[model samples]
Target: MFSIVEAIRQRATPQAVALVQKDRTLSYESLFQQCDALAAMIQQHVPHDPARVDRLRIGVHFPSSLDYVPLALATLAAGACFVPIPDELADEEKRDLATRTGMDAVLVLETLAGWLPEGTQKLGAFSVAEQKVLIQRLPAVTPGFPAAAFEGINPAFIRFSSGTTGKSKGVLLSHESLLERITAANEGLRIGPGDRVLWVLPMAHHFAVSIVLYLYHGATTIIEETHMGEDLLRAGAEQKATVMYGSPVHYRQLVEAPPVGEWTTLRLAVATAAALDAATAEKFRARFGRDLVQGLGIIELGLPVLNLTGAQEAPEAIGLPLSAYECLLKDDTGREPPAGEPGEICLRGKGMFDAYLDPWMPRAEALDAEGWFTTGDLGRRDAAGRVTICGRKKTLINVGGMKVFPEEVERVLDSHPKVQRSLVEARLHPLYGEVPIVRYIASPEGAPTTMELRNHCRAHLAGYKIPLLFSAVPQLPLTASGKLKRA
Candidate 1:
């Protein structure tokens, strides 16, 4: 199979610009050259086993920036799997991810490279895309899943669907899978060589698929460092950006703080990673004259549902699945839901994930008895086949579009001496859609003060995962089987 990088090189014009980050712009030829340089450095510096057929697992820990793009591409081009280390993750959380994925080495920015072990000899520092970065060799450790299983499908990226907790499923996507989904998504997006996308999302979380899509299609990606509304508009105007791919929070910022002038160049603005509020949708349309299309992007399945034709009519709808995808809404009885009624969203598409990395469940085993991959989300379908997400059935909570897992938070709370057991659940908020709240049974000694519990959690969890409210409860609700009741 032709590597995705090779495919990008095939269609791209050498001198045409491919990336714009603030003042720097890289032409297609320059981007490819940098990626090649990094790939060579990775092969030489990062350890590899000639005896093992499995690919090297390379972790990337960096802030939201353009430098991340080349490292990710170079990792993939070198036949290594890319695992992103999100900057928001705490120190312990970062260590957990590295161990869970069995990452061989991590390419980290100068200041962000503190996750390294003590007394290890580090590889020589290298520069890519004119930004200096360090390479640290990790102590050899085995991951939860077998190496052969991961290598079987030619894996490209393995990222957790939510947290890196024991219960969290590590989504494994192959090189072929990335190529397929991006091709399918672009059928509706129609992103091509001429389109420039104004992007603000962190590359670590989004680069594997979204960035690959743009590069594969020969579109220019403009990296606007700030999410500030005025800055985004200025960059869009200066770069002639044709697309805006960001979350609702970013769009709301654009709406609340009106820029001096409108971005007349944008033809499509997609709101993803969270539910798009109608207020932000309508206000953005009124201000910028571009419809805010909402798309459902899941790690298990690459972007399958996008609001292509119905955004102007119903801003809340997730719209129809692409022609290449088949979407099903299943009820509790394991049958299709009634017309215009909510059900658990299930999907089958061209580029579904290969397997769940931890505990080793393949796509065949992960799917429902009828064979569709059931997303733990609830939504309804209209007569015309347009759909909108209504609720979540899983313990995962979306805090301003970032995922916060209840089990991960509960683990931290349970570790405290003052807490015996804890339950975490999502509370609906007008702006954030949902925030995590905790209810716990205090230890026999007595309940800890809310301030004390907050400080205790702060040390272990990210700020977003820190529970919004902590309530002392006599007992947590239990189901008939004695399992903790999850609502």
Candidate 2:
């Protein structure tokens, strides 16, 4: 089985730029050395029971800085699973995660030192001066210990699903699973050396975590402290970034903003986390002279499918499945649906997570037998093998006897000029079982009344498909990964 730590060691070289920030850059060699030093420091101070050492779970609390990378590498190097606690999470949520994961220790930055639970061992931030002191003050631990060996099925990382419907569940990912999934994505996307990537999304999200596959291919990654539109465009030009990935929100801003004609180094742009509207996609392509590849992957299945090179073949499609993944759209009876028939999306592949951690207090059922993970997304495949997502299964609204998909209504609402963003949710109705309601964010200095929105939808949708109520809000509640939360 491949070890993530060993992969880093072999790949590290002085000439390879592994990390870049606003003011500084660290080569692969420096990154590896820092990780090694921190690994030794952790080994020296943390008590390890021989029997439990191999299964140690370590919680990490740090910002997306240079130090965070090495610390994460060191955790894996020390034969432990690293759980990243995003700084934006509430204090109670952080503690709850650490407690639920049964983390042996919490490695925290100085700024978050007080947030850790009592009795948790903390690792101080390693500065140049602190590194020297750690090496001098702490006794040297064994440096040449054999790296942890495991089967291909051994769990590597336990990522929690964004708790949109309920409490979060930990999704266990194995070494071979992640490696194969990422390799397939890298190959399919054609990411390679010399390709500079501007990473602005939160690292905690699987979308950002998938970038590690690019690093393995010798691509350079530039981390941005903030994700403002102008800052991202400026950094892309400054870093000569070739590949950029973000949500539709980011892409909408980029295409709508002032033109940057000279920023031509960008060759590939990817948008995920939510569906990319066709109109917006066309606008982006018209401005950049390059089509934005819309990637289709679920958190439960890692990033097994991509629509990179073949997006233009089917403008409304969500690309083809990755080489390692086998996808099937099945009806309620578990029978395969004919082409163009909408059904639940099912996947069986190496990229699929082993199991979801039980979130209920006493632990509850998470996965079913046969290992076919059912992604609750409703979609259909065309004759040419292109997948077009229709709506979410749980987000369907039942108006009397008719079934209404909120996404269909939301898409129409979003197309309006006065609507900045919109969400369609099912609300309980007295006569009808449930009716669809429209909530939207208005464009700057622009507000459209309920009747205007209704008229806009009436032009595109049937009578039953139209929302019964319209509400305007500044912003809709979203999960950490930016997916719309089901009401």
Q: Which whole-number lDDT from 0 to 100 does residue 386 have in model 2?
A: 73
Clash pairs detected, candidate 1: none
Q: Model 1 scores what on Cα lDDT?
A: 0.83
Task: Give candidate 1 regions above 4 Å deviation.
Answer: 128-131, 163-166, 395-487
Q: Identify the candidate with maximal TM-score.
A: 2
TM-score of 1: 0.81
The per-residue C-alpha lDDT of model 2 at residue 34 equals 83
What would the per-residue lDDT of candidate 2 be over residues 381-432, giving only the tens digit for each residue? 8887878888888776879978787888888988899998788888898999
How do the residues 221-312 of candidate 1 rate in per-residue lDDT, one tens digit apiece? 99988889878778888888999899887898888775666578899999987668677899988988888999998888888999888888
Off by over 4 Å in 2: 118-125, 128-153, 207-209, 359-370, 417-421, 428-432, 440-447, 472-476
How many residue pairs clash in all the candidates, one count each? 0, 0
